[model samples]
Structures are given as C-alpha cells and as structure tokens.
Target: MCGRVALASRDAVKACAGVDRELTSPTPLERDGEWARAGGRNASPGCAIAAVRIAAVEADDDGASARLARATVGDRRACAIEDVVWGVRFDSRRGGNFERSFNARVEGLLGGDESTFAAKLAKTVNGRCVVYVDGFYEWREEGPKGAKTRVKQPYMVRRADGKPLALASVLTPEKARSDAVDDFPRREAAVITMPSAGGELAWLHDRQPLFLWNDRDFDEWLFGDWARMARERRAKDVKGLLQWHPVTTKINHAAYDGEDASAPVKRAVEKDAGSVAALFAAATKKRKVDDETAVQID
Candidate 1:
C-alpha cells in the first residue's frame, strides 16, 4: 500500500495533460498562507494532491480570471484539476475517527469478484479521477543475517523518463457535482492499485498504482466502461518504463518535505559480520526515527 507520494509541482500535472483552462481549487490546507503551494514535493495523507476530472463548466468561468486555475476543454464538459485529499472521506456514523482507506486493491476491484465499494465507484461517473504525481515511496524490510526485527530501507519509484505518473483514483461524491469552481467542497479520494509486475519491481512492494499510459488511456479510464477494462486488466503495463532506487531516511519525519527529501541516494544497509547477536544489534541501530515521524508513516 502507498503511504506517501511526491509531486514535482502543479505545473507538472498541467503539462502532462496538455489541457486548457485550469481551475485553482483552494480547499484550505495551507502551511505558508498559500493554498496551491501546500502538499507540495513530499506529500502524504491529508495533503491535497491535484487530480484531473471531467466537470461541467459554465461559459463565464471558462476563460474568466476567477481562479484562471482549472483548465477547460469545452463548453459543457471539461477536464479540471481538482484538489483531492489522499484518503477516503470521513463517515460520521463510524463515530470516532476512522482510518481513511487510501489504497484500493485491484484484486477486490478486478482480479477476483468485484467488491461492492469498487462496483459503486465504477458505475459512478463523477467518482472517477486521474491523479498525477512525480513518484511514490515504498519501504522494504531487511535484516542483518538473522535479526528478528529487520530494518526498513526506503525507495523512490518513478517513470524512467521522469514524466508525471498518472494514477487512477476514485473521488468523493461532492467533488464534481457543482459546475462552478468556487463551490470549494472539501473532497477526498483513494488511489487504485494493482499487483506489481513481477520482476525488479516486486522487490519493492507487491502492488503499484494503476497507471494510464497516454492521453488515449486517460479518456478510456475516465469514460470507458469499468467492467470491460477490469475484464481485460487494461491498465498500462509499466514494468520496463519505471526505475527506482534507495533514498534517504529523512522522509521518515513528518516535517521533512521538499525535492531533496525524495532525492536518490546510496543504499544504507548494515554491514554484518555473521554473528546473530551482532546482526540483531546492527538492525536495531537504524530505528532512529522519532515518535512523530512514525506517526506520519502510519
């Protein structure tokens, strides 16, 4: 499951879509008094990730400078970049805080019997969304020989060409119901993940975001019938086009975010001399992350 993700910037998503007229969604999670600048480089849950979705656009806001933010494709339906929280929406019936479901498994949605949640998402035209990110982080647990408690190494995964990665996601019902951008609804979403292509990528994690290859795929995923796509397992196979490597552990901190936080670095591993006790001791030393950082990981 993806716990954290990174984006180059909002401009990257616009460039990737090559679309016109963007609606600047200001949904209030700002740290520097700027809304667009929030959840930037190293983004985690609760952060607003930019997502492209088809929405009804009125004639006035089509080119007007209200936000000059979201792009427009036509007079009726247009592709707009929406601010989507990286997790499921809250349900009051649950009473206390309910951990949001951020990742949706393909097995439940496509591979095996379709899940009721996925089924509803598939049928809801407004629920489909496209999220673009630069890369995502995954941790691999390793041990120094025979240590019981293994240390985890972080890795950043991205396209080989370093282009924006288009992820398939489902949005909350409130996102696109309004035709205007100023409605400013606080929306949430979950990324759909499929089993990883079994080679080098399997080493990092067992699942990966369902990817859209190009503009054609973007159209199909957002408009095409979900059952057909699911039956064919039509998600673009990205096995050869992706590259990943070890990254620094600074990302473990909730406060540590920026381009440098996700930068690639030499692998950090414990050098073991073969003793079980020595191996266990070496593994124990890497758990230097503080309590606050650990909370971010969860």
Candidate 2:
C-alpha cells in the first residue's frame, strides 16, 4: 500500500531540516532518535507522522484493473487522498499545488501532459471531501460527483466554513482514469508539510508515515470558478499560486517489510529512516487482490 507523512502547525518548518537530515543519512533510526533526543522544546513536537500500508493489490478484470490502477495513481499521485494526512486547506485553492505536483510526477514518470491528468482528475473527484490545513483532520461535504460543473473541471474547492481550502473529489478513481493520461509515472515523490493529530513534524522519504499536504501547486490548479470570478469582479486582481512541500515518497519494493511470513501485513514505523525507506518500496509493488485498504475521502 502507498504510505505518506505530514507535520502539523505553521512553525513546523523548523523541524523539517532535522527530519531531512536523518532521511539523507546512512542510518534509519537516527532521524527519529535525533528528534526524540532533541526533546519537545527543541523541535515542534506537535508534528504527527503516521505510516499507512498501501498493499500492491490486484484487480479482478480490465475495468477493475483500470479502476484500481487509475485510482492508485490518481490517489497516490494526489497526496491528499491518504487517510493519515490532515491539515490540507479546504478553500477554493485546496488542491492547488498538490494537484499540480501529482500531475508533474505522473507526467515526468509516465510521459503525458500534466494538464490532461489535472483535467481528468478534476472531472473524477469533486465534492464529498473535507480538508485540514493546520495538519489536523477536518471534514466538509459539498459539490457533485462524476459530472462536470458549469464553471470548469478541477475547480478550486472551499471548506464548509469558507476559509481553509483544497481540491476535492466525489468521483471514483476508475471514472477519473477514464479521461486520465495512460503514461502516468509509475514512480512518484512528494512532501507532507502540515502537522497531523499524532503530533510530529518531519519530511518522509518512503513508506513511513501519513501526513497531509504535497498535493497543492500552481500549474495543476484551477481556481477560476464562479465564486472566484465573482470575488475578482468585486475586488482587485488576485493571483493564485500553489506550493507543495519538497518532501518526497517513491514507488518501489523494500518499502514494506516483506521479509516476514505475513508479507501483506502493515509494517512497524518506529524509526523514521526505516519507515521512510519502506514507503518508497511500497510505491512500486504491483496491486494484488489483497491490497485493499479503505480511506474515507468524504
């Protein structure tokens, strides 16, 4: 299964470098150890990093395979889909950078137009979502699913409260992939900047933890809906630019602990280095029939 990590709070950036330091180093537990050793005051202990096991599940048929693969790519491609992630913005610019970054990774790996993927993704999932921008879990539901809105495909999504924002989806991955590009990258990378309910702040390299963010971006975003347009009409011009954390995850084997007899079981995430390494390995494993893990997008 695909796994991700996210940190909480605005000041979480302060702890990022330390996490990165352990990620790039030769040892695995060093990063987490360093953070723990630093104590709560030294680092923003509010950061929560959780790892999710995305089993390499196989589909039953062409439609199922297509759906599963598409959903995997689309969901994995878009960092916001993971359940462990939180604090994603729910405003109109919600999916902003996260969407584009996903498209870019797919395009770079699969060789297709990022816009095409974005457009398909726009159509695939709309409404039926809630976003947490402060690296915490929050929910809001609105919009239609599997149908086009008058404004455009992949429009900016807003939260019920009308403040935090993010790109949302009500459509299934199979539907989203029907219009998605085929050459989407098999490998991907992203970073989770926001904190999670677990209270840990750090960058992820592989199958370690689940934190939200890394799906918002400028190029792959669409905030030109009626609400935005109407707001633009009433006020001065506004520029919408999306940004994703440079933190990354990849698709490969060795990400999960396959060495044990029970290969499909979720692995432990005690050490940042070990878990992060596993995250990348899991990204590449082919979907098997057993790779089913449900995440509530709504």
Candidate 3:
C-alpha cells in the first residue's frame, strides 16, 4: 500500500486555490468514476502539499504609535506549508466572564464515526472544519454538577485558501448569553509550540495575534480542575479553559517525519512581548532556518 505524502511548491498561493480539484480527480472507471474523471489517470500515493496566505496588519503599540508588519512570506510568496506530525502540540481554552471554563464544544474536522480516539482525531480533510464552544444542559442531576457536559460543538468556518487561516483552536465564551442565540463563537489563533526561554518547548509559525500559554502548564491545570470538579460534585467552573484539535499539515519533505526531525526550532522570535516582524525576519536569515531539518512541515 502506498502512503499519502505532502508537497509544497514555489507558486503555493496560486497552487492552493486549486488544491481541492487536484486532490479530487476521478478514480478508475472500474473502481468507480475516479478513472473516468481523470481520463484513466491512476491515483498516486504521493503526498499532497498546499499553501496559505497570512496578511499582516498594523497594531497599536504600547507607545501609542501605529506599527505595520509584513506577512510571513513575501508578497509573491505565502506561508510555508508543512506536514502534520504527532509532536506539534495543540489545545483549546475557553475563558470568559459569563461561563465556566469548560463551557465549549469540540467537534471533529473529519466526520466522527470511529470507536477509537486516534481515528476520530485523524479526520481533518481539505475542507474539514469544526465549531467549538461551551454549552450548559440542565437535567435531574444533583448539586453543581449538571446532567451533561458544559459545552457543545455548534458552528464551523469555511476554509478559504489552502493554508488553513488559523490552527490553534481556542474558544472564549462571551460574558452574557441569551436563549435566542449561540454563546461562544470561534476566535482563530495560530497555535505553535516553541522552546522555552531556557531552550525547552517553544514553537512559532506566522506572526499573528497569539495567546501564550505553556502546553504542560495548561494541560496540568485543565486535568487538575476537571478532576477536582468531578470529585467535589461542585463543577462551579473550569478555569483557564481552552479548546483545540489536531490538523494535518501539508505533506512536505521527509525531514519533518519520525524521530529524525524531532528537534524543536530554536527561538528566531523572542519569548517576551514585542513586535515579531523584525524578529521573524532576523531569525529566518540569521538562524538559517531553511537549512534546518524541520523548517517546513510537509
């Protein structure tokens, strides 16, 4: 059996627009319509690669000046397309004034119909999308513990270009809710794991609005709070709530696969709060990221 691979090209922006069509070519007429659609072209097990564009906008600086940052890739180019791996960490947090931390829904990008968690999590497709947020179901349960989970997955966003706009899926519930409308809507954040300041696990990707929360710290808090709530029968609230699911990165070079590409990229961008444009630019050249093994995902 041939395994699917990921690929990225120089003209990624233009190429990604037609990614769905290329991947959707017809199969053999005998196998079905795939062959007829492809004019008898055989399916290749080669990895697929696509591209996305992240626009840069000006933000208000602490000094009250307007600062504009360029996009990650040059105007002619878009962000790098990488393959999805098990090591890239992801989490979704729900934080707001009106609802419990755990008040949100988590849905699969690919259709959910498997007995195993791994199968369910691997459903992300070209146009796969999910809507996550908190919900409250009241029933005949005793104490603060409700009869059902705090949230439900309700809405999803459309995938524009191939480069999945924002990856890190975090839903912050609104402070107030009404019986007429939905509560927490999705707010996209680019989720990447970078090494810690001391050179641990801090990740980076495009320069976009970011939420900084250490993976280990956040996971520990989530599990602890969830356990406490379950035991005390007082599911008062889950603090520092987040939400997220794994997304398949574009199939790229073999370098990012397996144990060989496991090392984390050193900080091209500093951990402190500041403008990342200059930092991102400096690092790509200064650190010679292109030569690095895990530079591109696919």
Each candidate's TM vs. the true structure?
A: 0.73, 0.19, 0.17
lDDT, candidate 1, 1-298, per-residue tens: 5578885566788788765556664455553421233445557776677888766522333234222223332222367777777787444566664577788776666655545465456545566788888888899876666877675778888889989899888876655433323434466778888776664577677787888777766766675555466455533456578888777777766557766777877665643334666767766765645555788999
As a whole number from 0 to 100, the lDDT of residue 143 in candidate 1 is 62
Candidate with the larger lDDT of 2 and 3: 2
Give each model's whole-structure lDDT.
0.66, 0.23, 0.22
What lDDT would candidate 2 get against the real structure? Answer: 0.23
For model 3, the stretches where C-alpha displacement exceeds 4 angstroms are 1-80, 86-151, 159-298
Query: On residues 119-162, what C-alpha lDDT tens digit does candidate 3 reach at each position?
Result: 23222111111111111111111222453533221111112222
What is the Cα-based lDDT of residue 63 in candidate 3? 23
Model 3 residue 164 lDDT score? 24
Off by over 4 Å in 2: 1-62, 65-82, 85-106, 109-132, 135-162, 167-298
Off by over 4 Å in 1: 26-39, 57-77, 92-95, 111-115, 175-185, 197-199, 234-236, 270-298
Maximum-TM-score candidate? 1
